[model samples]
Target: MKTLGIIGGLGPESTLDYYQRIIALYRERTGDRHYPEFVIVSVDLRKGLDFMDANDLGGMANYLLESIDKLARAGADFGIISANTPHIVFDEVAPRLPIPLISIVEATRAAAKAQNLKRLALFGTRYTMQASFYPKVFARDGIELLVPDLQDMDYIHDKYMNELVPGKFLADTRAGLLAIVDRMKATSDIDGVILAGTELPLILRDPIHDGIPFLDTTKIHVEAAIAHMLS
Candidate 1:
């Protein structure tokens, strides 16, 4: 099997999830106890968020490029950015990479398409929600994606940085997020929810919430990566 490289530590927790899930899934598929050959280049989370704060996407892309180059040098056949927020600069960084870089958005888009979900409610960091990337990708398949209201976006973003990224998943926060989902389901008639942030599934563990499927982007990306590796 081909080796995988991950650009991680966009936040520590989700990156760890990607690593663990990939190993477990690869073993289950191959029916082997041996661990897969993979390398992780954990970037500084603060610096990455700093670039986003300053609106210096070029700088962020360069930072990611440097890490991916290190992955190529470390013998990664292909690579993936383990978090969703950094994918704002994915188009810029991917073309410059030495190895193929799988996209969390594209992977999720494919999964959403497979489920025949026409409308989805997206929840993530302020960066992911405000951006046009997810909408643009899903629009290609005629899927409609919606973000929460500004107030809810504020709540989600605040909790994401202050709580989730630090590995703090509070019960009240989870309830608040679910409340937003319930509201969206009622107002927008959304058929599915896209857990666009990698850390989202860490808190919202269920596959379905009130009959709406929660699209787990991390798991989708891992499955896509494993398929790519085995192919």
Candidate 2:
């Protein structure tokens, strides 16, 4: 099996989740105690987040490029940055790396298409929702993307990150997210919703959509990584 490399620690918790998912997936597929070989280069998330908080694209890109190079040097066969927001530097990072970076954007697009989703709502960090990285990629694949209202985006950037991602996983957080989903359901005919943030699934469970489907980007990413390794 090919070794996987992860560019991680956009936030430590989410990165750990990705690592566990990779292990669980390998165990399930191969039914062996042995796990997939992988390496992780965890970057200083405070620096990245600070750049993002200030909307400094140059700083963010530079930070990501450096991290990707470190992963390449560490002997990653293929690389993946474990966070969605940092993918804003996908163009810059992709060209610099010697190994393929399995993109969460591409993985999510494939997941949406596989489910035949025409329109989808996205919930993630402010940068992810407001910027073109995710929406542009999905649009290229002929999928329409929707974002939450400004107030909700504020909730995500301020409260979700500061409180939920770091806080102990709680029922209230799940309720709050479901409430947002309910509001989206009322306003749009979206075919589904994408949990665009890696930490989102920690708050959301079962994701009752009444009828619409929900796409978990983290799960999609894990599946993509496993396929890349085993195939």
Candidate 3:
């Protein structure tokens, strides 16, 4: 099996999820005791979060590029950054890395298209929702992306970074998230809600949408990586 490289630790909880998911999927497919070799380059989430909160694009880009280079030097075959927000710097990171960087944007877009979705709601970091990176890519694929309202976006950012990422999953946070989903369902008429954050699935497993689908980017990303390796 081919080795995979992950640029992770944008938040530790989701990073752990990605690591476990990759191992489990690989084992399930091959039914071999040996697992695929992988490397993880976990950067300082606090710094990345601070830069994103400040809209410091240059800082974010530089951090991501450096992280990718580190992963390349550490012998990663191909790389994927686990966080959705950091993908905003993908354009900068891709060319600088010695190894190929698998794009979450492409993976998510492919998943959305496979579902024949024309419009999708997104729940992710503020950088992902407010920035042009993810939404623009989806738009190019002719899919309309709907983000939460400003207040909701703020709530998500705070709850995720302060609580969920820290492994502090509370009942109130879950209730708040469900409420946000409810509001989006009522307002957007979207075919699906994309759980763009890696940590999101930790809070919402088997998410029910009263009929609408929920696109779990973390699962989609892992499936794509496995497919790439097995193919």
Candidate 4:
């Protein structure tokens, strides 16, 4: 198997999720007694957020690129970033990385296309939702992406930074997020919800909600990384 490199700790909570899930799923899939070999470089969460908050995408790309370089030097065969928002600069950074960097967006897009999903509601940080990257990528396959209204976007971003990133999964916040999805399904005819944020699946664990599937990006990304490793 190829050595998998992960640029993690975009937030500490989701980084742990990526590590645990990759090990568990890899074991189950291969029926192996031993775990897959991998490397992780956990960067500062605050620095990344600062880059986004300042609209300094170039800085963000360079920051992630530096982390990926560390993974390469440490002997990773390929790399993947653990968070969604950093993917705003994925195109900028992937080409420069020494190892192949698997994209969370492309992986999710393939999953949606396989399911024949026409439209998906995206939930993530403000940088992810407001950015055109996800919509543009999905649109290549004729899939449409919808984000919450400005007010809901604000709420999602606030809770994401303050609660989800910090590992505080509250019932009221979960309910509020579900309500947003329900509205999108009703009004926009969405077939799926993209838990675009890695930490999202931690709070919204169920695969399906109100007949619309919640595409756990962390799971999809881990599966993609494992596939690349085994291949």
Clashes of each: 0, 0, 0, 0
Which segments of candidate 3 are over 4 A away from where they belong? none
**Model 2 error, position 231 (Å):** 1.8
lDDT of 4 at 195: 99
Per-residue C-alpha lDDT of model 3 across residues 165-215, encoded as one tens digit per residue: 889988889889878888888888777888988888898787556777888
Candidate 2 CA-lDDT value = 0.84
Model 4 ranges with Cα > 4 A deviation: none
Candidate 3 overall Cα lDDT vs. reference?
A: 0.85
**Candidate 2 vs candidate 4, TM-score winner:** 4
| Evaluation by lDDT, superior candidate among 1 and 2 | 1
lDDT for each residue of candidate 2 in 1-231, tens digit (9 for 90 to 100)? 888989888777888899999999999999988978899998987898899889898899888877777777888788888888988888876676678889999999998888888888898988899989888888887899999898877876675688656856777767777777778889876778898888887777575467867788888999999998998
For candidate 3, which ten residues in a row score worst on lDDT? 204-213
- Candidates in order have lDDT scores of 0.93, 0.84, 0.85, 0.94
Predicted candidate 1 versus true structure: per-residue lDDT over 1-231, tens digit per residue: 799999999899999899899989999988977888899999999999899999999999999999999999999999999998889989887768899998999999999999999999999999999999899999999999999999999999999999999999999999999999999999999999999999999999999989999999999999999999999
Cα RMSD for predicted model 2: 1.4
